[model samples]
Target: MKIAPNSRVLITGGASGLGLALVLQFVERGARVLATDVHEEIPDSLRGLEGVSYLTLNVTQDVDWAKARDWVTETWDGLDYLFNNAGVAAGGRIELSEMDQWQWIVDINLLGVARGCRTFTPLMKEQGSGHIINTASAAGLIHPPRMTEYVAVKAGVVAISESLFHELKPYGVKVSVICPTFFKTNLTESLRGKDEQANKSAAKLIDKAKLSADTIAARVIRGIEKDRHIILTDRDGKVAYAAKRFARPLYYSMMKKASFQMAKKD
Candidate 1:
């Protein structure tokens, strides 16, 4: 999984946020980068950049994945890296979240990665060596109050990627799941704003945490080069993950206490 200069890479949701950051980093590293996003326009920073191409894509759709894969095969001949980074954040306790909201979040955050990995793996398998990076979240490891939809989907992503790691190992392909804490991104806007009350408090909580997209992208490149399976972006995320793994009951009890404290304050 060593990304030598001029290696071929494909990334989804690359118009902005961490996807855009990864695109810029790979392009600068001299990798032939193909990026896609639902956004019709390319970012000014990536426009006219050598060794980079942008396309419009909706990761949730099967047709979009097929089209992108075909385009990559035709244009690049093969892919060395595939970053399944498209995701959307939605907040609400499991009992309170709307069904449509859950479906939307899961479709993007979980199913999107699943579809990408399913379709793209065979293509990469042909090349005999490739890497797949799926963007998960710290909340996937340990859930907080609210954000149930996002947390559940991200958790599923981690599970899927972890499973794929073993499945693809025999093929000489690698899989990496990026579990990052709150990063400076527009993911907060993807929350269910139609239900303002449920999302307002969740937004405030997310705002208090600091995780920069630029920093996350740098770690992603390093992890891909090292062929690391799980890439925890924030040091805090690593610690939190360790705590959850060792003491699940204690970890959740502490969260419950914090939820009561926040409710009391409100």
Candidate 2:
């Protein structure tokens, strides 16, 4: 699906990070963007941007989605693209992770995307053309040890996006799953872990990664233009994806070594 001029786009978690970058990119490309986040105030950088508007939406809530949908329907008559990008991070050994943390991560990361898809699909179908982009992590394709809850939820997103791609194709709606590696984002602020030391170590590792949200968002726009299904952002993430697909043992070994290093750092 091409992001043409005047395209009506809605993005969740647009207050910061990749979501915000998407908003800016879409707006710059001449699309009408409605950026939503749970935050009461829109980010300062996005405040005065033309062709872009802000709405408060908690993707986890059905009511919030309904409100957002209603606003889009009323304002623009329909949506051309829906970005289900709101998510949180969690890390810990599966056995050691708390049940509440598991629930929180799943609800926001997996179910949040599900809710966005469910809420906006009908509208897109009615319009007869649209794209749905779900942000799954590279961890979804190559499971990293200790980030059990996050990996599980992201894996679920990847699976759902694949399924939806086939299911929605007949209706002229395209679904793309974004599997990106760690980049500088506010995701660390929401990271959950039982061990503070482990959390800090993980944050440090992510901070060292060179990719930025703007680069990822730019890639995402290109992927959308090309109608690509699996959008990967970084070299490491693309390599990990290929390794998992064509060389399973090597992928596992690489992931295991990385996990061991992180454990040692902690």
Using TM-score as the measure, the top candidate is: 2
Question: lDDT for each of the candidates?
Answer: 0.83, 0.89
RMSD of each predicted structure: 1.9, 1.4
lDDT of 2 by residue, 118-173 (tens): 99999999888889999999988888777788889999999999999999999999
lDDT of 1 by residue, 120-224 (tens): 899878878888999998888888875677788888999999999999998989899998887777777777735466677667756765767888899888887
RMSD of 2: 1.4
On a 0 to 1 TM-score scale, where does candidate 1 land against the true structure? 0.93
Number of clashes found in candidate 2: 0
Displacement of the residue 231 alpha carbon in candidate 1, Å: 0.8
Task: Report lDDT (Cα) of residue 44, candidate 1.
Answer: 78
